[model samples]
Target: MPDFLTLANHCANPRQGTQPNGLPYYDGQGTLTEEMRWLRSFIDEGYLWYKEVPANLNMADYKTVLDYFAVLKTPLITASGQPKDRFHFTYPSEVWEAMSGAGVTLGYGITWSRSTGATPRVYVVTMVEPDSPASKAGVLRGDTLVSVDGADATTSTALAALSPTAAGQTHAFALKRGESTQTFSLTSQKVTEAAVQNTRVISTSTGAVGYLQFNDHNAIAERQLLDAFTTLKAANVSDLVLDMRYNGGGYLLVASELAYMIAGPAATDGKVFERLQLNDKRPPQAPQMFRTVSYGLAPTSLKAGVTLPYLGLKRVTVLTTAGTCSASESVINSLRGIDVEVNLIGGETCGKPYAFVPQENCGTTYFAIQMQGANNKGFGDYADGFQATCKADDDLDHALGDSSERLLATALSYRANGVCPATPLRARSSSSTGPLQLLRPVGKEIALRPR
Candidate 1:
């Protein structure tokens, strides 16, 4: 690895020319102060909002520098000055390597969301990865977590126990299923998430509806989606319902490929799936077209070299919630750009139109908002997020992909009648319902991992 100055200079946007203040950038043996000076200079020169920042700010340590830099970056702020940059953060190299490489983490393999309540009492299971300890322990989506190790599951201690930092840790869980409660003792392990959770062909009165629960857009998801579409196509399904309520987004290529699969070659041929806009200092990027091939985990690798399977559907129903974001929104945006009908159900998506390329400096990987994605029509400013066509609650009482699930059922109802459900499942307010805790930790959506 190069020195911090060299590494910073190499990729920092608006590369530093002579200092604007005409001060010597740094001249020392890389002391703490010198490093801070180098970082300050880098940010002062390259930050999108450098001019708006105060010239003198306290920088006592590395963490302070990061905090200060975060405050100075202006691109993250909305036009009215609200902070809109949740995607900007830094991670240690090892953590970044694990997340970007395999999407595995030390936990029990359950992605959960808290139910709105005053006192956190139930954690609703949103996704369960295949072959994980939680899955092997019979944990299913919609299961309500009541307790952990005899303590209220919503308590900080129980939540901490649920996500053990070390492998081989054991935790007992009490889950509520309908009227019955089940208990399971699960041992924490390294869990690799399966991006494609569930796929099936539902026999509907209208026709066969392909139901796919797409959780993430990781590299493995590229192949899993291809296989799922191949199965759907063989089943001769007429309509598709894509479940992305809990998906927080991943690679842009996977997003593009998914759009390609939903809209076949004829519909997507020579179309711009997504166009990336960099900062004013950088040159414009070429549009990312619908892909027909799957790439390896090494994001740039084409070693797998398999042609993507297509569904060639005219319309798709996408289930969404606040968790749906980034590349996930891209799928909805790009498809709509090309005139494909996308009917959204559930809550509004997490508004995120920006992406980042991980840049390493010293031992920390920085994920800064570097580019904005737009559709063919050049509409991309969705910072407030896309609203659902048919408003529906994420029914925690029913399993995802189940015919009776609130969001899925609403979508099915809309398909049959072309009207939104009048009285969708209503969500309980936090005061009325006990506080529900989110057990699983959320990970970053690294658009492109450095190989």
Candidate 2:
């Protein structure tokens, strides 16, 4: 297998730079001289921030290489100039395969958000995968986890550790609901997450409102979304509320297809959904076009397709949060680009106009930011995130997709009154306008899964 240095040189964006200097021709190991030379050559050819790299940094140390890469992030000037590069990271190949290929993860099947306030922290359930351990154990969105295996669930580290890595492992959870605390014991299992959590037609005085709690943008989501829209269309729904509160995003193709479904053939017949801009070193690729429904994941296999059931909607209400990112943001941006109204409810989106094509090296998958995505008008610099049109709390106290949920209710209120409800002073103080935090265990990367 090629060493890390060689793989880094071949795959890193920019693909050319200065070499690092160091000692150690042979640190008690054979042929240190050749290894050091190769390291210098790799750095010179592939380091994106070669000019900023310290000349005296140890060239042969893998840690040194990673440390250098960490600091050499290109600052995105549009995002309030915050020196953040959270998009770059590496994970084990097995993790990448499970998450990208199967949408599987070892846990109790609950996605959560941690509160940043005082001690004895609160960990609230954001979404629960259907039929997963968490759901089976009676977990619901907005359930405040008071304790996890007897430990307080306030800290992020504590909350993360609650996710079991091994199957059949049991953990105790004490959740607070309606001023009462209840305990449930759940055994961990390999959860295959369903992208579409819940879909129903809500009848109100105005008309039928299609409510879809879309959790992830994985490949299976393509079929799930098609089915959801098919039902909605059959019901003759007039409006849509796409709940993407806990969706961190997955495939761009799915995003495009969704935009096409909402806007329909008339608005998207020949429209550009998103445009990708590559590094100056590579040739620019064609813009991604809005696509109709297809049976398979690949574009060429659309022969078995039916006419996509589009809402033909000129406007849509999207439920968002800090967890709404990447492909999720893409859908919002693309729709707005084509003159479609996107009424954002809840918190600001996690500003990530950038994306990556996962590259494997030394049995690890590296998600390096390589491209920027813009809409038809070429306005894709939302590193500071898209602010909400109507601010509302997540209202973990109520179930998602419920008519009474704060965010959902706010959207419905806007639909009826054509005005944003006054954001309560308390809700505004706890909104997601603060600095973005990494919501999921894995870093964000938008790519097509292996078919």
Candidate 3:
């Protein structure tokens, strides 16, 4: 096989210049078939489950490059009966750059919760980014989506309308929250995300408990976390509830920093937070150590040499769901590795200890399981995901960070007492609803991150 670079940069629509990330494009003599071959060889060499990928998948049988790439992943199943390699996919390189960098995207800025594999689908807004189109329209959490563009929300046509298109494309949405129904003609546009939100000190009888909704692990997250930690430090909060139910993960280092900030130097100063283990054919990797100081990495973060504020707590409560993935899972596992108890609430995390550095070739960025992660103790076998300590529905009726919210309240109660409630909360439903549903993000299915 030829070197992968020899077959790269053969875009059908070859870019005219460099991208916003300053990646330069070059001309290539490569063809579509050569590009496909490059991918086949790349996967054979780099994928963690390289041996499980079918040996007989002839590239000629596929029509499009995407179709060929789709069938290249392992067909193996996990012990949990789920597909072992569900996180394989690709993205337009530019789109990934914006998201991994500043957490910006084109959308209504509403993270919705949809009932998976349930008939007569029900979708609810779990979060609305402040100042975005969804928030400007006064859309709130707990608002059940009834219709899109006058069609039933469950229908394929209506659901397609909600897919991201371009800025200024408008769609009508009918939603019901409790007894009141509201409709919105919302437009899609570039929405800069607030990676961390709803940060506040919840004054409990036990002490000041700090809580913050962390939605992404992008570059901007570093600064926001520093600011949030600073606030929590000033309040001297005794406990912390990190809400990561919708975070799909980003940079691995950002996750390590979060773990350090939670556990502090006493627990993590000399320990590894997470170690990336590549496939058998690859070289050994250096473990990702717990970061102690801030580099002011984000475009708008504090200047270099600023010390990070840590909670120095031995225990932390994390709010989670299946939408909590990759780097988010790393934070939980790493904290637990150092014997810093992570009491989880909500649902189990999306089981994915694997990560891959995005590789851009021919204008597309590819994601594959190149490495699996382990915590300090070198244990990384939670494929089915970390189970919740207290099973509580995400209470959308009360805004996130509110003390009455189910997940936060449960965390508070669990900390007060070392046990879960007798009966856990479930998503509220009327007789008209289907099986009990849990809050899951309507955004990307898996994490987009590096290890």
| Per-prediction backbone clash count | 4, 2, 0
lDDT of 2 by residue, 79-130 (tens): 4656545576667656776776567888888877766654444567767888
**Model 1, 1-451: lDDT tens per residue?**
2243553523222223343336433322334454456556655443444455565567763355467556555544677466756665777645666665666677888877776665544577767778888888899877877888898886887888866878999988999877899998999887887778679999987899999998777767776787899999999999999998877787888888899989999889989988988666667667888887776654443345678888898899999887788889999999999999999998788788877776555445666666788898898988888998988777766777789888888889899999997766565423477434334333444355223
TM-score of each: 0.85, 0.82, 0.94
> Which residue pairs come into collision in candidate 2?
121-154, 142-396
Q: lDDT for every model?
A: 0.74, 0.71, 0.81
Which regions of candidate 2 deviate over 4 angstroms?
1-58, 64-72, 75-81, 154-160, 298-307, 425-438, 444-451
| Model 1: ten consecutive residues of lowest lDDT | 9-18
The list of candidate 3 runs beyond 4 A from truth reads: 27-29, 295-297, 300-305, 430-451
**Sort by TM-score, best first: what order?**
3, 1, 2
Candidate 3: lDDT of 17?
Answer: 69
Sequence-dependent TM-score of model 3? 0.94
Model 2 residue 182 distance off true place after TM-score fit, in angstroms: 2.3
Residue 381, candidate 1: C-alpha displacement in angstroms: 1.3
**Which structure is stronger by TM-score: 1 or 3?**
3
